[model samples]
Target: MTATTLAPATTEVLIQLRPADEWLAVCPLSRLTPGRGVAALLPDGRQVALFLDRDGVPYAIDNRDPFTGAQVLARGLVGSAAGRPFVASPLLKQRFDLSTGRCLDDESVAVTAYEVRAA
Candidate 1:
């Protein structure tokens, strides 16, 4: 009978499939001015416009123009509802939901909205 002992490997390998938190820091609140909108680049390479409503709360919405698929929503106009935040498309003047990414005028298409904060 023969007995053999195996030695353990000294090196450790670690692989991460996804980020601990899906959120990636985009910008600082100081850089994102209030009452004005700024374009934020996401980790996935998509752009979103972050705006602060008249009440000074932050809202985020896709930067793409829903009608033409162009990246022009960042240059669009920002307005408010009874209190809800919204962005108007620069191309066709269509309004979209800042929270749920739903088109106010159209129902079939939708953009994306991300959770935003002061950096």
Candidate 2:
């Protein structure tokens, strides 16, 4: 019997964000670093923080910090609390949930959490 060899598979993963009705392609999946974030400017001049978890899950949230009014969420520290992924602001150390964009320290405050996908 002859042996068959199978070719390796290759998939080009892309990261996308939906701020409004249309989905915007930000960058390739390779551009993101696990446990870190990068900032991207939307078409409407809004800044967004993009992250890829160690498990390859992508998340996007507004880069603006409502408490300090600073656009610095991308530089925040990425971590998990109670199985929920969050990013703690570098300046004030307030944690924001990556999926919901809700301030963990303050329930009444929240930022815009964009729909993110890796495809």
Candidate 3:
């Protein structure tokens, strides 16, 4: 029997964010390391934090920390709690749910969660 060869996987996947009506390409998926995040500046002057989970799921949220008003969420640490993925603020240590952008430490506080996709 003859053996068949398969094409090598490509890191051409692009991470996109939908801040408005259209989806904007942020960066290549390979640029995002699992459990780490990167910051992207939008056309409207808004900053967004993009993350890739260990499971290869992409998430996007407002980069600004609601409590301190600092744009440093991209530098936050990512992990999961109660089966929900979250990122802890580097400054205040407050955890924000990556899916919903809700502050896990405080139910009343939340940030904007953008719809993310891989294209």
Where in model 3 is the C-alpha error above 4 Å?
1-11
Sum up the clashes in candidate 3. Answer: 0
- Higher lDDT: candidate 2 or 3? 3
What stretches of model 1 exceed 4 Å from their correct place? 1-21
Lowest summed-lDDT stretch of 10 residues in model 1? 11-20
Q: CA lDDT of each candidate?
A: 0.70, 0.94, 0.96
lDDT score, residue 65, model 3? 97
Per residue, candidate 1 scores C-alpha lDDT tens digits across 1-119 of: 89988998664321111212655555555555556677766667777787767666677778888789898877778776666677888889888878777888888988977766543
Following a full C-alpha superposition, what root-mean-square deviation does model 1 have from the true structure?
11.8
**Candidate 2 pairs with clashing backbones:** none
lDDT of 1 at 113: 75
Q: Provide the TM-score for each candidate, comma-separated.
A: 0.73, 0.89, 0.89
lDDT of 2: 0.94
After superposition, the stretches of candidate 2 with alpha carbons farther than 4 Å from their true spots are 1-11
In the order shown, the candidates' Cα RMSDs to the true structure are 11.8, 4.2, 4.5
How far is 6's C-alpha from truth in model 3 (Å)? Answer: 18
- What lDDT score goes with residue 96 in model 3? 99
